[model samples]
Target: MGTQFWVKGTVLCKTGAQVVNATGPELDKFIGKISYGLFHGQRLKQCGLGGRPFRFSFFPSLMEVIPASLHISVIFFCSVLIVFSSVASAFFMYNAFGSPYETLHGPLGLYLWNFICCSCSCLVMILFASEVKFHRLSEKIANYNESTFVYKTYTERFDRSFWIILFTFLSHTLNILLIRLAGIQFPFQEAKEATVNTGASDLMY
Candidate 1:
């Protein structure tokens, strides 16, 4: 009698079939190559049990998706949004503790505004970090490897939070642009000239 050794495992596929039979050696080699692919940030193509092949691609980094010429503009806008959001959040927090805002808007309203601004700022920061750090790429790899094999080339899309933060930022930027377009100066600047004239009139008197 001859002895035989057979190692068996399941190959997960996203489409067509859920489970396919695979040998231990094949699974080992496939997993080894996948580890290397993940380390080098490379796409992987592997064949499943039934001779079905699947491709896995990582999500492109932000810079890859964005043009170099517009890089500075993007950075500038993100920074401005972050700063303004932080400042607005702080202002709201301060008002939450005080008299006029507490009486008029109430603590809840002030706190709500504060939370929105703070959350928007934090979410923007996280998005910026993910852009540089390839966090989404890692996530894609994990998701594809979990219980299903991803077939198509991975495409990166902005999440809802990203759009929300972007819209908020753009709205604030538009407000500033409109003020400048309308030739509106700060109240302090308008008061400065009045103060100077009043001082001169007092001197004359």
Candidate 2:
């Protein structure tokens, strides 16, 4: 039988990677430059994962974004939370007329449930992404033909999942500070507010 083989996967590493073999010193320096940025100073703009930067008039100021990216599920949960809280608040206002004054009860419960669900879902994504193997060029080449399963890098695979989780966590802990500093503006009012008046805004005000 003729030696037959099926080429699999895209030609990523083949793009001059194999041609330019590096020496020990060169390789070491290259590795050092990888820049995890998990704790870097100028690692704000992720380049192109989720949000991109623009000028509202070239205004000079500082903005700190969640270095991470977000998934639909996480984002959806947050959005739903906003909706839930708003509806609940409105419902609370509705009952102020002459009802039991407990109208905030239902929306409050729903918002809580949505918040928990969103949080748990986000956690699951982060854990799952953390477990993902952010391999090197050599590793991908090793499994070049295991299956036609072409996936993005650990970075690309989850589309900034790491940053998403990190930023999301930070947003929770340092929400007020973030707003005050105005370093970066991320939408977290729903989650943050839910944290306090979360007690069913449907009642007081």
What shift in Å separates residue 56 of candidate 2 from its native position after superposition?
A: 35
RMSD of each: 15.7, 17.0
Mind giving the per-residue lDDT tens digits that candidate 2 earns over 1-205?
Answer: 0110111111122222234564544332212101121222111111112322222210112112221233233335445544544554464356556465343323334234334434654664453344233323212322233353232222222234344544644543353343235332223434554444445442332
lDDT digits (tens) for residues 6-44 of candidate 1? 111122233323244445554432331222121123333
Number of the top-ranking candidate, with lDDT as the measure: 1
- Check candidate 2 and list the clashing pairs: 63-183, 64-183, 64-184, 68-163, 68-164, 69-164, 92-202
Q: Which stretches in model 1 have alpha-carbon errors above 4 Å?
A: 1-126, 129-133, 137-153, 186-205
Which model scores highest in TM-score? 1
- Model 2, TM vs. native: 0.27
